[model samples]
Target chain A: MPVLEVDHLSKDFGKGRVVDDISFHVEAGEIVGLLGPNGAGKSTTIHMLLGFIDPTAGTIRIFGKSLRRNREDIFARLNMASPYAGFPNRLTVFENLMIYARLYGVAERAAKIRNLLGRLGIEELETKQMLELSFGEIARVRLAKAFLNDPQLLLLDEALGGLDPYAATLAKDVLTQLQREHGTAILYTSHNMVDVEEMCSRVIFLRRGRIIAMGGPTEVTRAILREDRKKPALSEAFIHASRGEPHAVE
Target chain B: MRLNRIAAVIERHVYDAKHNLERVTDTLYWPVMDIIVWGFLTLFLARHGNLRPGLISFLLGAAILWGMFRAFQRDLAVSFLAEVWSHNVIGLLATPLTLREYLSGLLAINLLKAIVGTAAAALVALLFYSYDFFPYLIALLPFIFVLMIFGLAVGILVTGLIVRYTTKIQSFTWSITGLIMPFSCVFYPVSALPGWMQPLALALPTTQAFEGLRQVVAGGGFSWERLWAGLALDGVYLLAAVASFDALFRSARVRGLLVRIE
Candidate 1:
């Protein structure tokens, strides 16, 4: 069975639907990229999957258990890391990690904090408060937090938003390693297509809250090129697809 | 299940506060300043007349209680506001951390701030003013417990307002808490108030705390009626605050206002 199964999930905001009927699946050890431009409902879909927002209709299951009924159980095995999620500013980096580790109910918190800090190459900066860290370090600390529980299913919402090219590449390698070594199923979101093309095994294209395309990145890119002579790059393919261009339908 | 979640949140706040020692001090600083400045000013004003030894002591005790209360309200409201201002609330929302967890964590932090602030005020009063610490110290725990609950209720109400309305209201919380004066009977005996003002002043939960503290410290016995009244009134306020928080959070989720800073 797939590690995650999202079935016809829909969420409405006020009078309009922000995340329309959407469905997908992720097998263990698979890295899936949720790609979309701003306001494409990528975050909304992720939020619903994480049980942050209730769906207007449909079901989501993790490890074959219903998310609605077993959210705490599912959440115990799952974790999300994003720099955008606020950490207490006055707390030191060590303190921030320790707090999350405890919340995730990680045993032997001291060792866990030390191991994760070392893993993230942030051991030296442990004592520094969060406000003192550079943006890149903060991003890396968030990444550390996500994997703190040794999560089986990791949802990374714009996980690499602030990293430089080298750091972003290192993060990608870490994600790849996490999957290969631990069988972690990752749902990655990013605007950077090159990273998506390199890191993801499969791609899900969202346009105004609907999944427009899903397949291997190479296969989708090739198909888009074959169908649209005007656009050559995957970025252009994304815009063309979102605009309801006729070529994207195929 | 509900209790488990609440405990999880409380644990998170304890952890956060433990690592962030600077924040605890930062939270208590302004309130400490309020005590130093206002405590002296009230003394100076009352010195010209008969400063009832018991009344003056009551005023000092009320200042200490009020300081802790403001410390809690300001700290919790500002902590939540800081998250909102920095645009990080949305990020926390995406995690397994529920709204209740977030609110509970902040509330715990506020409670801790009240304890620390009260302690600091007592220490300072002891060292600087040659004040008798025994009665004040004995009354400290119960006084702070009631005052913290009252402060938390105000904090939740203010936080709910901040989430739904503009952040401009955040500044008003401290000023209004300071303004809870005449009703609290911080400066004079409740009996000294005009006939009609007596019931009105006595209705405030903090007034009961002031009266009870004086009865215990100077009058030589604990006032059961005042203690129970304070707890009951403050309990109702806390329930109202929690209800308002629930409503605000539900509307915020629908309007997407919880994560919106401006």
Candidate 2:
């Protein structure tokens, strides 16, 4: 069974529809990229999946339970990391993690927090306040918090954004190792096409609140350049696809 | 509704208070200052024999009770504001912590602040004016409970508005109780208000509480009827506040304000 399933999700904000009818699922141990430009409803979709926003229509099922009916049960098996949201600025890194650990009811919390700090290579940042940490450090600490519960499914919304190349690479590596070791499913969103190409086994492209395309990176890349015979980068294809341009010759 | 989740939220705020000296000082400053300032005024009035008998006790009691009300109101609103300022609301809502648990945690925080502020104010009152509020503890309990419920109700309503509207109306968090204080008749009898305002003053639970406090300080017969009336009114206000909070919360979710509100 898929670890995450979103079916026919739609959200209307009275001004207009922000997320039109959309559907997708993430299987265990799979990394799926949600690719889109800004305002393409990537964040909106993630928000819905996390139950932050109530969908005007459709359903979300996690671990075979309806999200609307069994939110706590579903949330117990999933966690999310975002560069947009943050921990309390006044709290030290360790304090932030400890609080989240207790909230999620993680047993052996001290040992788990210590292990996550070491795993994320943020042991030195334990005492640092969130406001004092660099953007990269904040992202790393958030990732550590996300992994605190050993979530079965992880929703990463632009989790790699704002990091330097080295930090991004380190984050990606840790995510990969964590996924492999724990068989955690990840629904990763990013504008970094290179990271998407390297890490995502399958990509779901959204544009104007609709999925323009979905498939393996190689398959979608081939589909994007099928008629042109020129193997443009995923970023180029993404730009073209987002513009509603045809990938194949008629 | 989970104990661990509620404790976790409270723990975060406690840690925040521990780390932020400004927050600690802000909580302590008002009650202590009010006592000192009012204590001196009462002393001068008594020294000159300018005040009526029992007026000093009245002033000190009002100050301490008002401090309790303010503490409850401010702590609840600040708890919500803290989440907004830190951009932690999204993270919190995304977790298993339900809105009910979140409010419970805020109430728990308010209780802690109420205890500290009330005790500090009471202690200052005892030392500065020789006014002992402790003997009236049993009488004050219901009054304090009514004030707390009303304050919490207002705090929830204000927090809900701030969440739905973002920081545009954020000033309501602290200013709202001040706006209600006049109607509450904290320092005077409801009859002292203008004839036009008496009905409105009588409608407030705080008015009933303060009036009851005055009666207790005057050594008059305690009015159980007044306490019951205040509690019943508080129940109505509490229900309305919870409804307002729920409505605003739903609207916030629908508008995607929770994630977008900084």
Candidate 3:
């Protein structure tokens, strides 16, 4: 069974449908990238899947259980991170980690926080408040938070933003390692084509709240390249795809 | 069928508060300042003999109630705005926690603040005034509920506006209660309102709360009738606020309004 299933999910706030009949599935040990332009409803679609917002139409199932009915069950095994999400600025990096670890109900929370910080090469930053840490450090803390629960399914929404290349690589490698070790299903969202293409096995493209394309990297690439094999890079493909260009906008 | 989600919501909020102690303390500055300012004012009034002993009791009650109510309202607004500001609301939603749990957790935190703020205010008032702070204090617990529910109701109403429209109106929501001090008869009886506006005074929650406080202080014993009235009104207002909250969230989702703020 799929770890996460979004079936014809639609959300309408006022006049327009931001998430219009979008459907997709994420299986165990697989990483899926949700790619789109700035206002493409990618976030809205994810919000619905999480049960943060009620769907105007359709349903979401997690681990083959209705999201509405089995929210706590689904949430216990789920964790998410976004670089844009702010950790409490008043708390030290270690303190922030410890708080989340406790919320996850992890045993020996203090030890777990220490291990995660050490693993992230952020032991030196443990005493510094979040606002005092550099952007890259904050990003690492957020990434650490995402995995605090040893989540079975991890959601990353632009999780690499604000990280230096080295930090970004480390964060991505950790995610990849977790997928291998825990069979953690990952829903990765980013505008960075290189990272998405490199990390995700499957990709789903969204535009103004609708999925314009989906499949393996090669399949999606082929769809983007269409008749031309020697086309521009993936970033160009993303731009062309979202712009409704003749070759990639299908 | 699982209620664990509710506990999870509470856990997350308390966790966040614990982790963000600095920011939480910074946020409490306004209420703390409110106590200091009013604490001195009550002292000055008492010294001048202008604040009759009966009025001093009324003022002490109002000081505590205002602190709790304002804390409830401010915390709700700031917490929601903080999530909105950081784009974290999206992340939270992706969790198993529903909006209902999220809201209930916020309300719970506000209740905690109400208790602590009420205690601190009582201590400070004791230092500055000569009233039996504890005798009438049992009534303060329910008083906190009255203030918290009303504050939360207003907070939800404002949050609905924020999710759809500009949150510039949030300032208005926070300070609007300040007007309640004078008109709600926080420092005096509603009868003091010119013969023309007693009905207007009755419309405010503070009127009944003060009357209840006075009844307890005068040894009239607890007034079941007044307390029930306040609870009934709180229930009505809270329901209305929740309705607005639901409608606004739906409208925002449909219109993609969530993205507008983020």
Q: What DockQ does each listed candidate score?
A: 0.30, 0.77, 0.29
Docking class of 3: acceptable
Best by DockQ: 2
Predicted structure 2: lDDT: 0.86
Clashing pairs in 3: A12-B254, A13-B251, A13-B253, A13-B254, A13-B255, A14-B254, A14-B255
Which residue pairs show collisions in model 1?
Answer: A85-B91
Q: Which residue runs of candidate 1 sit more than 4 Å off their true CA positions?
A: A12-16, A54-57, A63-71, A89-92, A108-129, A132-134, A222-233, A247-250, B1-49, B85-112, B139-141, B166-168, B189-203, B217-220
Q: Worst ten-residue run, lDDT, model 1 chain A?
A: A223-232
Residue range B23-117, candidate 3, lDDT tens digits: 46744565556667776787788788887656666666666666777777877877787667656565565455557767877777666766676
TM-score of model number 2? 0.95
Deviation from native of the Cα of residue A154 in model 2, angstroms: 0.5
**Model 2 DockQ, alpha carbons vs. true complex:** 0.77
Rank all candidate structures by their DockQ, best first, as comma-separated numbers: 2, 1, 3
Q: Residue-wise lDDT of candidate 2 within B1-262, one digit each (tens)?
A: 6899999988998899999997787778888898999899989998898999989888889988898898788878888888889999888876888878888988888788788878888898887678888998887898889998999888889988988999888888888888889998998898899999999988889999999999999999687978998999999998999899889988998888888887
Kindly report which residue stretches of model 3 are placed more than 4 angstroms away from their true locations once superposed.
A9-21, A36-41, A52-58, A206-212, A228-244, A248-250, B1-53, B79-87, B97-116, B139-145, B155-166, B194-196, B258-262
lDDT of 1 by residue, A1-250 (tens): 6999999988888788888888999999899999877888888777777665667888898999987667667877888875447676776888767766666767887788887677667789899988898988899888888887778899988889888887776677777877888899999998888778777888888877887778778656655445534322567667666566654422
Proportion of true inter-chain contacts also present in candidate 2:
0.79
lDDT (Cα atoms) of all candidates against the true structure = 0.74, 0.86, 0.73
